[model samples]
Target: MAIEIENKDQQHPRAKKDGEVVERLLQESANDNNLAEVARLRIRYGGFPGARSMQRNLDIVLERWNLTEEGLFELTRQIHAEGRAYKRNSNGEEQEDWT
Candidate 1:
């Protein structure tokens, strides 16, 4: 006998809630380069089993942002090549990590 699983498209309630937050954060990051980096990190490393909503959010961002996984990785490569990272000053502004 063959069995089929149902509700495969359903997302967990918590995941759905988190996805909304993720979408909002991504939208806010558009005008903030520093925040963009943080958002990218969240998208890249926040994977877990049964995180359907979060994954869907990431897919939407990638499509809407017109960015590919390889492009994102290349951006990271350039940042590392420059030996700098986004830092914040005491005044809460983005600064370069010179050290």
Candidate 2:
């Protein structure tokens, strides 16, 4: 079964809403009818290439609510092998090849 749906960018799926138990908390600013959805989006889309959170979906909720760090590390646990990881520099722009 599919979880949260992805936003227009189609980068990753939403996260705030789980299988229907936990509630989402979005930022007041820019937060309106779509705020809950956006919060869900940040959680879901943020943890791409892997599961929802380090342990489970709840963690994603906590991270987003506190703005502490939701599934942030998951993005760097070497989720992918050399062939899958982005071959870019810290700046995110693709690096040049010399060797």
Winning model by TM-score: 1
Residue-level lDDT of model 1, residues 62-96, one tens digit each, is: 66667676765566566656755565789987663
Q: What value of lDDT does candidate 2 attain over all alpha carbons?
A: 0.38
- In model 1, which residue pairs have backbone atoms overlapping below 3 Å? none
> RMSD of model 2, in Å?
16.0
The parts of candidate 2 lying over 4 Å away from their true place are 1-29, 50-99
lDDT of each: 0.55, 0.38
Query: Using lDDT as the measure, which candidate wins?
Result: 1
Residue-level lDDT for 46 in candidate 1: 58
Q: Which stretches of candidate 1 lie over 4 Å from their true place?
A: 1-21, 29-47, 89-99
